[model samples]
Target: MFIRIVKMSFHEEKIPLFLDNFHSVKNDIRNFPGNNFLELYQDKNNPSIFFTYSVWNEESDLETYRNSDLFKSVWAYTKAFFNDKPQAWSVDKLESLP
Candidate 1:
């Protein structure tokens, strides 16, 4: 599995507007191919910050989504709200005990 933790900070006064755009992006990505799961969380330390926790079937799955129209549309609107370049990374488990 692949995971991405995306962090975004919106302009404080524009948060409600950002949330509206976020809802749209959330719906678009949810229906994309190879998307296993997705979640959004707010930073306790910083209410202006948001995090996107997502799981993908594979790296290619994410790439496919990234290259799709959904991503393009979502990213275009999302970029306008970014306080900085959002952070994202593909990650995997090194080891797990259960």
Candidate 2:
């Protein structure tokens, strides 16, 4: 499995816009080809900071999604609210506790 995590920092005043945008597009992302999971998280101390966690069947699947129009539109809307450049990591699972 391919695990992808992205950290985003949004402008405080634009947080609501970000949330609305996410709410509208999240389902499309979760249903995208080769997507297995999707999740969102927020920082305890910094409400403006958020993270997206997702799993895909493979790296190529992720690349295909990233190049899709759904991603293009979603990213265009999302990036407008960013307060800082996003950070991301793609990783492979080595083990599971259970």
Candidate 3:
């Protein structure tokens, strides 16, 4: 599996709006085809900064999602609140332990 991590920094005043929107569509994203996991994290020292962590069966799956209407609409809404350009990375899982 591959992991996708996205770091986003939003305007302080827009955080609540972003959170509400995320809550509304998170399930749909998590259940999207080829997606195995989804999570959100916030920076303790920087309230405006957040990260999205997700796992996908393949890179193509992520690409497909990126091109979907769901992603387009969600990203358009989310992008408007950004304080800075978002950053993302895709990497392979080297190991995991239960």
Candidate 4:
């Protein structure tokens, strides 16, 4: 499995708009094919900064999602609220320590 992390910096005033949009589509994202999990996180120091942490079965799965209409729709609206360019990473698990 692999992990996809996206760090987004939103316009402070647009945070609520982002949240509302997320609320409406998060479920569809979580249920997307090849998605293992989905999570949203906010920076304690900066409410305008948020992260999306998700796990996918493989990199190709992530690519597939990125190419889908769902992503196009969600991202189109989501990016309009960004204060800065979003950063993202796709990584494989090296190890897990319990």
Best by TM-score: 3
Return the candidate ranking by lDDT, descending.
3, 2, 4, 1
Where is the poorest 10-residue window by lDDT in model 3?
87-96
Q: Please state every model's RMSD to the true fold in angstroms.
A: 1.8, 0.8, 0.6, 0.9
Clashes of each: 0, 0, 0, 0
Model 2 off-target regions past 4 Å?
none
Best-to-worst order by TM-score is 3, 2, 4, 1
Which residue pairs show collisions in model 2?
none
The TM-score obtained by model 3 is: 0.98
**Model 2 C-alpha RMSD to native:** 0.8
Query: What TM value does model 1 have?
Result: 0.88
Query: If scored against the real structure, what TM-score would every candidate get?
Result: 0.88, 0.96, 0.98, 0.95
The positional error of residue 71 in candidate 2, measured at the CA in angstroms, is 0.3
Q: Please report the candidate that would top lDDT against the real structure.
A: 3
How would you encode candidate 1's per-residue C-alpha lDDT over 1-98 as one tens digit per residue?
88888889888887888888778678668767888889999999998899898888888999999898888877887788777778887789688799
* Cα distance off (Å), candidate 2, residue 26: 0.8
Task: Give the alpha-carbon lDDT of every model.
Answer: 0.84, 0.96, 0.97, 0.95
lDDT of 2 by residue, 1-98 (tens): 99999999999999999998899899999999999999999999999999999999999999999999999999998999998999999989999897
Which runs in model 4 stand beyond 4 Å of their true positions? none
lDDT of model 1 at position 33: 84
Extract clashing residue pairs from model 1: none
lDDT of 4 by residue, 27-56 (tens): 999999999999999999999999999999
